[model samples]
Structure formats: C-alpha cells, structure tokens
Target: MTDHVDVLIVGAGLSGIGAAYRLQTMSKGKTYAILESRAAAGGTWDLFRYPGIRSDSDMYTLSFPFKPWTHANAIADGEDIRRYIHDTAHENKIDQHIRFGHRVTRASWSSDDAQWTVDASTDDGPVTITASFLYLCSGYYNYDQGYTPEFPGLEDFEGEVVHPQFWTDDVDYEGKEVVVIGSGATAVTLIPSMAGSTKHVTMLQRSPTYITALPQGDPIAGFLRKILPGGIAHRLTRIKNAAIAIGFYVFSQRFPQQASKFLIGRARKSLPADFDPKHLTPTYNPWDQRLCIVPNGDLFRTLRSGKASIVTDRIARFTKTGIDLESGEHLDADLVVTATGLQVVAFGQIAVEVDGRKIDSHETYVYKGMMFSGIPNFAWCVGYTNASWTLRADLTSQYVCRLINHMDARGYAFGMPDPAGASGDAAPLLNLQSGYVQRVAGILPQQGSSSPWTIRQNWFLDAWDNRRADLDEAMVWTRQREVARAG
Candidate 1:
C-alpha cells in the first residue's frame, strides 16, 4: 500500500510549520502531510547547536505572523526558537502530520496522473509517497555539512578543531585559548559567547564584514504587548521591525558610501581607542554582503575587556600551536573553531524529474521567487536575505495556499509557469554578493528582469502583489483529461 495526500510538504522547520498552518486554514478541505528529514522539528534551529546560536534577525519579524511571540527578548536564543517552533506545531496539531526521519530523495511528476511520486530514505527503509502537489520547505543549505575552505597545513594543527555547525557538548573550550576563523555572523557570535569562559579568544578573518550592534530586547514591543492584545501587538511589532529592516536595506543600497561610514563609525565608537580601524573596515560597499549583528554590543564589550580580539589577515599556514598570519604574526590557541559559512543547496538537493525528463534547476527561471519555470504543482519556500526569514516565508505559504485554491476552483489538475512568458535577460536568483550565495550560483535557479519572474527583496511589495496576483499571468493551467487527451 502507498501513502497519498493532497499535499506533501518537505521540512518541519519554521517555514514548513507555517506552510502547514496556512494550508489547513485557507485550503480547508485539503489533506496534507509534512515530511521532515530530521527526527526533530525546528530545522535550522534544531540542527545548529553552537554556543551563541541566537537569531541575528529580531524575533518579532522572524517568528510566525499567526503566532504571537510573547518572549521579552527581540533577539532570541536558539533553544527558545526551537521551543517556539515545537509549541506552534503542538498547538496547531501540525506534529500529527509530520513524518520524522523521512528524508525526501527524489520527486517524480507525471502529467498523466497529475501527481508527484516522492521517494524518501528512512531508518526503517525506503518509503514512497504520492501527492497532488509538493512544497519544499527544506531551506537552502546542506544540513549534513557546512562549508569550510581548505586551509594549508590544517592537518598539522595539534589543537582540537571544530566547526560551529557540528558543535557538540563534549568539545570543551572553557579556560582555553580559542581562535575562530572567518568574520561572518557565526564568528562574531562565537567570540562573545565563548570569551566569558575562555582564557582568550581571537577572531581570525581574511577580510572584514559589516558588523553592528542592536538592542537585545525591543522596548516598544514590550510596551505594545503590555498595553494591547497579543495578536495586535505582534502585528504592529512585525510591521515596525520589517519597515526598519527594509528602510535600512534601501538606505544601504542607495547610499553605500554613507552607509559604510555610518557602520564603521558605530564600530569605531564601540571598540577601544587603540584598536586598528583597518581591521574593522571592508573594501566593498555596504549591503554587498550581509552585515553581522551582535546583541547590545556584547562582542565589542568583550573586545574592550581584553578577553577577545580580532585579527584581519590571510592565513599563512596552520602551525601545531596556532595559525601563522601572512603578516608574520603568530597566536597561540588550544581550540580552533571554523565558523566559516553554510553550503547553499537548491530544492534541498533532491532530484526532481518531470515526465521521465530530469529538470535542471539552473536552466529554469524562478517564478515569483517561489516556483520554477515549467514546473507544475510545486513550490519552494525561501525567505528574504535582508530581513527576518519568516516574513518572506509567511507570504510564500499564503501564496501557495492561494495558488492551490485557485487551481481547485478552476478544475485545473496542474499549473506551471510558462518559460516563454518571462522576458529579458536572466539573472541569479539571489541578489546578494555573499560568499555562500556566490559559491553555488551555478546550481541555483535564475530570475527574470521583470515582475512575476523577478525576485525583489521588498516585503511590502511582495505582500501587496501576492494578495492581488493574477492566477493566469505567465501560468499554464491544464486538467487531467487534457493531459491524457494530448498524450
């Protein structure tokens, strides 16, 4: 016997749970199931157990729109976020629909059947399931491994080396000298988090990234929650935070020089007087890559206290005791942490086939930043790179529900975006020049130069356009009989 459903959603993380909620509420009669690769929920929150694994984005916008984030802190810890996702699942009964330990390997679409046959690997064995539509909420990164660049003589290092993605309780750093490689969000986060217990901590970087400080808690959100209802307060806070994020991004893009100065100035004010300004400055303009955030200037405070330090230089090689810099500086360390970056993957790296033909994602153009061109009854959930992930994720879920409902009402068995409809030169799906994104640009999908096919990072525009989107625009709808007759 084969398991079947009206919808099969991949992942049980933030996006999957929200997708399930929207599907149940909006598309009432649809039967759905969530297939999670991991044994637990919370996806990224559950997978990454690093020391200072709190959200860089504020929780007000990062959290689901339907669920009010009652926590006082705007920047929430990883465990809190994991718990919140679990609580949401439990409250909505979404947990009952989740099949844990089932990692989807392949999805095959048949135009004749107007359904998808999905193959998944599980502890028990291989499992096959069929669904009318497939929604991939698996995120955009490889969960099994994080990206770490090959460093010369890495094997020669005598100290214990660890990657933030694979952090374990047994790997101790307390009272020991530690050096963290890369100056991304993970590095900044780990430096402050580990500085308290470590003898000394150093952040080693090839180049500097834009780093800034933000308050750990939102005072306005706390006030709103106290004075108004939970739902209203959540909505208002989400709007406020989202607006601020969008405004900042716009300002950064339009006035890169001023933005760079403002960010560097803030960092300069936070750091010690003798600290080299060159170490904090980057060659690229602001918004070229993502800016790292530290809650309440904790990282700066740690740096000022002499517990932690930053070194901006290329690696000469890894020594037995520490890494040798290109500038002939040597630092001793007991433990080395590679807080490098994540390996970006598309469609969870699951092989997708349509009517016995393998569909290459790179060749396909993105439709509304969610669906691929020439792909029927399928959607991928990816969040905004500039703002809290949940903001864009929520909009995507709602749009998926709307698309499903539209198909059902029109008696259409399947709907695919027409490749011909998308005009103009194609561009990379993601707009950021971040290392992680640039590394896998060849594998990711493409976006058109105009709306419906363009991926604009604006939340307000996406929300409004999604609400009023035309179901027929650049879409090819067909019924089962039509497919059969054509065949």
Candidate 2:
C-alpha cells in the first residue's frame, strides 16, 4: 500500500505514449502513472515480432507530432506500428493511466523530501512508488535481449535458432532455409520479409549496409491527405518528411564522396544484371550505420527475383546444416536468424539513487539530451541518431513540457543539471557507430563541451536549442527547505 504520483511514467512505448500525452496535456494538476514493463503497448513496436517488423524511420518522421500518422504507409508494418500505439493509448484517456506489469525496479532521489521513490516490478509483488517527476520513457535498448554473438559452431546448429527479438507464433518460416545474420536495420528487414515465406532468404553480412529504395506510399502524403485538413495534412507531411530527412542527413555528412556514389548508383539501378551491385554497398559513410530502407524496391526485388540472397562474408562457424564462410563458403541453413543487434539497455535496467549515492550513468553529464548532470527531477528520451526517432521524440516531449511548466511557475522543488563544473567535452551520448552503439559505449551518458551540455543531433539544432531555451541557464532550482512549522 504505497503508491503516489505527480508524474512517474517509465515506458508505455513510443516514448511512453508520448510521455503520457505531454504529462496530461501540459502538467495540469499532475498525477501520472504509465509503468509498463510490457503487458503490451508497443515499445519497439511491441518488442518486434520479427519477419519484416518495419519502420526504420519514415512514419512521417516516425509519428507523434501530436498524432496524425493517418497511415498510407510511409513504411509502416509491425502491425501498423502496433495499431498506432493502441490508438494513441485509446484516444488520450491514455489507456487508463497504464500500469501493465509494472517493472521499474529502483529510483531513489530525496533532497530532504523533494520526492521520487519508485520500485515497481509486479505480478502482485514489490510495488512502492512515490513521485513528483521522474518520467523516463524507457527506450535506449535491451527489451529483454536481442544481441547474440557466440557462433563457433553454436552448439552445432542443425536448424531452428532465431532471435528477431524472440519472435514467436509457433515460429514457422514455411518452406524454411532462411539465414539472415545482420547488416543492420534488422538484416534489411529480414531479407525482404523472409523472402516471401522462406525457402530462400540469405543475407549473411559482415559489412555493407547503405541500401535505399523508399516510396512505400506517400505521393506527397497521399496528395495532402486528399485535400488538406487532417491537422493540415499532418503538418504538410511533417514538413515534407522533415525536410527530406534533414536533406539526407546533411547530404550524407557533407558529401561523402558524392554520398557514396549516390548510394552505389542507387544499388546499381536496383540490382540484377548479374547481381553484384557491390553487395549493395557500405563501408561507413551514409549516416555511417543506418540506411537500409527498402519499401518499393523491396530488397532489390528480393535480389532480382532469385528469391533473395547477399553474402558479403565472415562467419566461419555454426555448421550442422548452415554457415561456415570464412572464405570456404557453405551456407545451407534451415533457419538461423541472429539479426545481430541491440542491447544498449540504458534505463529499463533501472537502479538510480542520489541521496544514497549510486548514480554513475557513466559518471553523469548529458543535459539537454534530456537531463542528467547531477540528476534531480529526472528525465530521459534520447532520439535521433541522424533523424526521425519521432523527430527527437517530438522535441523531447516539447522540452519536457517546458521543464514542467517552468517548475510550476518558479516555486520549484528540484530541477538539476548545473554543469557549472563542466568537463565532458562532448561526443559519446550516441554519435552512433552502432554495434549496439559500440556495445554500450562505456555505460552511456557524457555529452558536453558546449551548449546546454551538448547533444544536438540536429532537428534544426534541436529546434533552436531545445525549443527556445532559457529556463534559467543550465537549470538548478530547488526549494523544499521549510520545516519549522511544528511550533
């Protein structure tokens, strides 16, 4: 019997249902909930259900500029983005303040009663909670494992061994044969959705990622949603697909050899002609580690209709029926999918303290990338490693509802991030080199050496520095210091 809130939220998916619709439409009378350790509510589109689980950014900037992704496929899938996050948490009732299987696991913070207790993890077990701000939107990876790399004869394979994040449904790749190792974006979206029900889908990969095709419906956002209106045709198709994904990530980082020869001459005019389009290109450069999207060319028409395939090389093991190519080549497979990625578990692994110490999120720093420094009222979002992670999660939920309405109009209670003693010379809080962000870049957090603790993966410089800054430079606020009223 210990539950309270003014804002708790920790992951109801898609940035915890858009941070509970911006803390119930801008902090009015507070009182939040949203625990969700998955009983459902599409976090990673309901923890990816394998075979073509889509959206590698392109649901018009990955949705949530206050909804309006009236789908017409701008590369959707994953059950229509988990039924548009269960219809945006049941049309804003926010699905009765969520709670699904709880699971927070720890969060102390005190400052002599400035609140925040938390503990979660439930099936009718450990509960305790208390809050006054702590929203994390649990995302930066590890939704119960999905990065497996052991293969030295992986227990002599002999078929069936998948891991598209534990995909089930009595796992059946129909005619089977599959292979799919990883080149990123879930092995080019499971080699064209498991090459039309398997019997042939290879992929393998050791290097080479940049592939592109796009156009899974969006003729100018379906002709401005049939003559404008639906929120101005979703804000002019989210500002023309966020200015064409920020002009193709600043023209492939300022023209990397003419953007890798215009993405290997558009994958050699969409493959076939003896295949070879240099194994669909990539050796870094082109968002350096993410650029797969295959909407219309559908993985070069499943590798020019030979069903599907693409080797690249480097495996040397796991062979009871499949894989062995350290240049001897084997590849037989009945099923082996280890779309090799993801495991950067930043926050869902909870545990944070403060009064009792234990904070060390890589010796804390990150601020505008959504609060951290010395952590106080707390906040967490982390989106955009080039573009469209809900376009910096809708500007970090509108700058965390303008820093909780400017700490309740200045009466304050806690706020943090006073990096006055700064010393993290920026560049680490995910500048993506991906292999699950360089295997947990020394336990995350640390981006400074400039503006509001630096981390601008540009959404127009985080909308002119986190939606027009100036909430008392680098914040600090306090005020729970009055206790002599017992006279």
Instruction: Identify the leading candidate in terms of lDDT.
Output: 1
lDDT of 1 at 82: 99
lDDT per residue for candidate 2 within 1-487, as digits (tens), equals 7878878888888888987887788776788888888898888888888777888778877888778888788889989989988998999889898989988889998877777899887888898889978979887888888789888978888789988899888888888888888878788878887788877988888888887788888888888888987888887888888888788788888988898898889778877677776577777788867677778978888788898888898998887888888899898888888989888877667999988988878778787787888788888887887777877876787788788788788777777888352564556788768788988888888787777777776787678766678877777787544311211
- List candidate 1 stretches off by more than 4 Å: 484-487
TM-scores, all candidates, are 0.98, 0.35
Candidate 1 lDDT, 403-462, residue by residue in tens: 999988888999999956477798888888888999999999999888788888899989
What's model 1's lDDT at 8? Answer: 97
Error of 1 at 156 (Å): 1.0
Error of 2 at 205 (Å): 13
RMSD of each: 1.1, 19.7
What lDDT does candidate 1 reach at residue 272?
76
